[model samples]
Target: MRGRGHRAGRAARKRRQKQESVVQSVSLCHELQYVRLMKFLHQRGFTSTLLQPALFTDTGRGLQAVKSIKPGQLLISLPESCLLTTSTVLDSYLGHYIKSWKPRPSPLLALCVFLVCERHLGEASDWFPYIDVLPAAYTCPAYFTDDVVAVLPSGARRRASEQREAVRELHSLNQNFFRSLQPLLSQPVDEVLTCEALRWAWCSVNTRSVFMSHPSNDSLSGQDVYALAPFLDLLNHRPDVQVKASFNDVTRCYEIRSVSGTLRYQQAFINYGSHDTQRLMLEYGFVAPCNPNSVVYVDADLLCDVLRGDRSLDQKIKFLKENNFLHNLTVSSEGAGWRLMTALRLLSLPQTLYHLWKAVLLGQVLCEEREEWSVQTAKTLCQRLLQDSHTALDKITNLLRQCDQPVREQLDVVESLRQEERCILGSCLELLEGPPRQPDELLSCAPDVDAVS
Candidate 1:
């Protein structure tokens, strides 16, 4: 028994060592690739030394400040030759053949084709250095396996489905367009535009491409509005940071300046707009733990579900549709908006008072009596939403507990989303369940309401 135990321990140690070696090899390869990419950019006029690659224990690869960067300092300036724009793709060797197709492809589709063709050329392609460093697979929910996708919350699942459909449509277009060129081409269509190849290229473009507005005098107006700005695209997103990026016609380079200062060794980030956690996850394949714009969408269907037993449901639905209040219901850090509360109040009104409610909704009159019912109805709806959110969160939490070690990281992202949602719903519930005040008290306190009335 002692001999067997000793053998087993030795085997385990060997396996761990092998795994560590593999990980180290991959890290080393990535470091080399980063160096090559940086060198490539430097040769093309990226001279700023403020940014350097910094690996985090948890966040993987991100750009860090080598020296303290002051606000308004230009951190990167890549010449037009470095930008992988639609024009560049359209002007490439592959683009020469793509233009012969019956109908010209959109800039995005053309870029995807260019990516696949360039990849097929392997080392011979001019863009090989840039292409080699692009991520092999994306983390976006759109790339999640079927089982993982099935577990996504309804909102995320819907968005993922939409993205998948878009990819499918683009793939179909590629197929049809490539089939037409197969007769003239020496290579098989599959080898040139395989689904897997197209998908990789599609995701690379989706996640890495930056929007660049063309100059008014540029002839490429209304073409592809996005470009792949190599090193600049490597900057991770933080909601708080602001960056001023633009194409400098005078210098003939793309410039990115930090509007906010960065401390030495701290990761510098760019604002990807005011995206919520869900939007970030769907589009960028990662969620920001501290996204200030994080919100929980309370769709009209959920609202309708909450008011399922209300009388004259059809009438309420019609009114909601007519008033265009059946959508855009959301809860954020500020809690539920007034529109949601007003919509719930409208639903709670009796059939006889529908006209009065409509009048109030249209700002024709002030119905003080229904104000209490509105507040009560809003509270009830919030309570239901809060309960449902908690249930969803519990399911996700339980799944996390039982999930396999390999998939736990991905599940953690879903868990973060659910937790944010729960926080939003909880906040809304708190606001709705605040101490009930008399309508007169509310009116007296609101000088604006008194004046409006």
Candidate 2:
């Protein structure tokens, strides 16, 4: 009977705690201007998964959750969250200045100021100028914010609460972090403010990594939804945004050419084109060719043109000799220009079959510079290959053998490129081979030399 009563008491306590959490959450939501923010986000096509409130504020007043939003959107955490208690304390001049200055507010910049000012400016003087805010967001002394606890699944919430408890148990954790920075803060107030703002801004980036791994769950905490919705959609940084000058008038907003990081802007502009080309050459995904002649994926003609126009021939040759043909080439003096010849010979595969593949792979064969290598090119190549896989394979094999050292090295590349798991190249290769094995039969095969070696 005592045990039964104890169980009943525990259950009642849990119910009370949950009810209290909800009430506290709703109240804090108003305090943080979440409702206003949510309304704004809704207008922008964001859906909230309001995470639990207690997880937000250690003492029970904050929020956490995952939010669903479109890519490359921007989210603005309002000015109200900072001004809640002492908004009336602003100077008339300052207030007027803020009202008149129509700098399109940056969320990253604003959040950085808020985190730092929360520690310094008391009551109403916390609003910092946006111009002073941009540097920290761009670079950093570093700042940190953790994932709001609401992004966790329901089963994990109890554990998340436990983790929060553990964090609190180490009461000196936050104090320690701040205490170590006392020397830095003793500098001029402006310097201190700038550094602290940068510090926390850096922290926010790190905190994002923690939440980034969270899987989508059906149910979410209010905080989780709120935080994520703003971040991934509206607050995401794009090179284009850097290119854009924030302005009150749309006409004046075109001053992005003067902005720093113009190369990133250039890339963004190219990416935005109707070509929608993958431009695999620009992607950092692959290392540059080791053997120029052996690799057809690179546009040798364009490279030659670029090199010939600006750089020394010797330097160009040296770059190709060092980077392309082979990093560890054992060139024999007896061979003379053999390495160069070999590199050029290897360029044949790309000139033919691989050329067609690169087009479809990059989605840009139809592009003006390489129109002959697009889908239409693939159709042409496929038609020729269709005459007989065996015949096509024989030609490829003969070409591979005669194509010099650089071309012969690509035998491994062709084999690896045929991996079913890697890319569509594998499926095409499979067709070149015979019928594919059934899943069960494929699974039953013994470990082959190809896989192990």
Candidate 3:
């Protein structure tokens, strides 16, 4: 009996060792400090780690330049070993479950799963140093409260709903895939991979990941083109700065060339590309002042209502949609956008002049009467938008003055978005009501679409 007990003890030790190995292989994240992160990167082949985390009043946390850097300087050449990408996921213990599951998970889902799982692993996670610095919460619509979401403009309302629904649906759809990872995880997959957990992971990937092309794979539901880089993701976005960022094939490092170099002690910023104010607010959770790409998206129902009096509206709307000209209607800093003008001209056509729709679309000048109708219709739309903008702005002001609530920050973001949108509408009206001059290609031979202010 004593010999039998000894044998059992030996067996127990073997199982414990196996569990430790499995845990170590897939450990996630713990609270890693800046010093440790810098140290971690230095050891992993990063030579020029000459930056530190800094705080800015305007942009919150961003990387600060410790030394003066010149134009065309290679600001950051991050090694690929630091990237946590889908390839890393596919090679882990969870990879086999991902492969043999009845339905394949999206490449995005795979990345989110890895991040959440690793984060749950705490100190055991190999990338704990990097994950420790990631924001505990995000400001994207997915993180917005019900009260905050209730106040979004007509244009952004649909998109915000879809963003939240996407997270929820993704969580609901992938229950089996989550369950398949039970053998590798310390707890039940549901506990670690909750909907809230997935949401946090999804936002991290959406807001922080970099663009890195991946090898073609039929297994992923969509393209797997994102990679999470550690120090590289620290750079905040600045619209005016010019930079060249890419992965260097020979060096196997993700490099950034700062065309507009960051000065010493200044916060460094990167360009997220021609994103408008609303886009910045919805996807990344912020807004920019005087964004050139910013525009007010016209509501389709409002567009239809404005043209309802015309008898041929039904046929005109059909032609516009069929030709793919109905979507993307907008008003911008330059006044009525091309797409909006194009659709309006078609909608303004008299029933007898239906054949001239193509001519109108192609920038041909219709009769003075038809041109006047289109101009009047545009003016009406802009007027309605201006009223809506004013109402929202005033409501926001009153809410802020009336209370100092926690939703103040959310209200402020929406305020900036609204203000920029109002600017675009105001310009549209000036263009519509401006002096009669040479008609531009956008309109059916009417006044030039120029913003006076």
Candidate 4:
């Protein structure tokens, strides 16, 4: 019996060791690929002396600073030849096929097709080293399961569905174009340029591309703004990072300069522009922790629900819609946004002073009574939103415990968004709890507090 127990313990230890070995192997494989990609970039006159590809605990994969970087220093640059663009597509073997095709493909389609085709070429492709490092799958909502997307906040879910549909429609719309390339392909173009394949390429373009503008290629219609900068695309985004990125004609390279220095061994970041959690998740498939620009949107349905009790509901709704105050209502760390305040004021206006509607929008305060009503309406709406936030959080916690990585990643992003919304609502709710403020009364910004607990 003792011998049997000892044997079981040894077997368990062996299993643990085997799992650890596999993890190490995978990590080492990633490092080798990154090394090859770096070598590939260096050969093409693009180089990064201060940064190396690394797996960040918080941000997954990002470029890490190997040496302390000084402010206003050129961090990294990619030569014009390294940029994967419509111009690049036009120069590839597909050049004549694209040039003579009727109803020319859009600039975006040209890039997406190039990505999918090159990926199928394996090591035979010139861009193989760079392509090998690209993500096998993306976490963008476009790839999300219906169950996962259903868990997103209302505004995010709506946009996610629209994006998913657009990608599918894009694949459908370009069936003829994908078919047109069959004769030029080494293999069947349909098999290589599938819906799933196009989805992957589309996401890569959407998330990893740098805004690049060059002389428009006559082969494609639409603006040529997309450029896949190999090593430069690996830099992660942080809302607070200061940097200047531009195509320098003198150097003939796309250069990124840091305004604020990065510390040695720290993950380097660039600003993706002041995007909130919603845009971050919808467009980029990640959530920024403690995003100062984060805000909780009050969609039209919620606003309508808020104003349902008013006697002039239809009139007020029509007025708000006509004046463009019907949507984009939001609450942020800094009290209510101007649009929300404006809509609330219109709803709270007395029937007698209806002509002042336009005036109210221009920042005119009607009366103390109307101000009180707006404040109360905002408070009530916030309470409902706060409750919805709590419920959404609970749902996410349950989902997290039941899922695996990848799906777990998507759920985690949605959870971050809900948490941010909770904090934003908490800030807004606390403001409303104070003395009755004016219709146009904007409160001083407050520190974020998570009310989920």
Name the top TM-score candidate.
4
**Which structure among the candidates has the greatest lDDT?**
4
RMSD of each: 9.3, 23.1, 13.1, 9.7
Better of 1 and 4 by TM-score: 4
lDDT digits (tens) for residues 87-192 of candidate 3: 8888886688777766677889999998898999998987787777777666567866666676677768778888999999999998878887888889988899
Off by over 4 Å in 4: 1-30, 438-453
lDDT of 2 by residue, 1-453 (tens): 000001011111121112232222223234243455455445545443423222111112222332332233221222222221112212322233223333422223333333454435423332222112212221101110122222211222344355334434333233433333344344554454444454433333222211212223222211221121121211212223332222213331111122332221011110111110111111110111111221112224433432343323344345355545533221111221233233322222222233333333332222222222122222222233233333434444555555543233222222221121122323333442443223221111222221101
**How does candidate 3 fare on TM-score?**
0.85
Model 4: residue 250 alpha-carbon error in angstroms: 1.1
Task: Give each model's whole-structure lDDT.
Answer: 0.65, 0.27, 0.72, 0.75
Q: Which parts of model 1 are misplaced by more than 4 Å?
A: 1-30, 180-187, 214-223, 351-372, 383-409, 437-453
Candidate 4 versus the native: TM-score? 0.88
Per-residue lDDT of model 1, residues 39-128, tens digit only = 787787777578876553334566677799999998777888888877786576655566565566767777787788777777777777
Tell me how far the alpha carbon of residue 207 in candidate 2 is from the true structure, in angstroms, after superposition.
5.9
What local lDDT score does residue 43 receive in model 4, on the 0 to 100 scale? 85
- Candidate 4 structure quality by residue, lDDT tens digits, 283-304: 8777667678889898888887
Worst 10 residues of 1 by lDDT: 1-10
> Model 1: clashing residue pairs?
none
Error of 1 at 199 (Å): 2.1
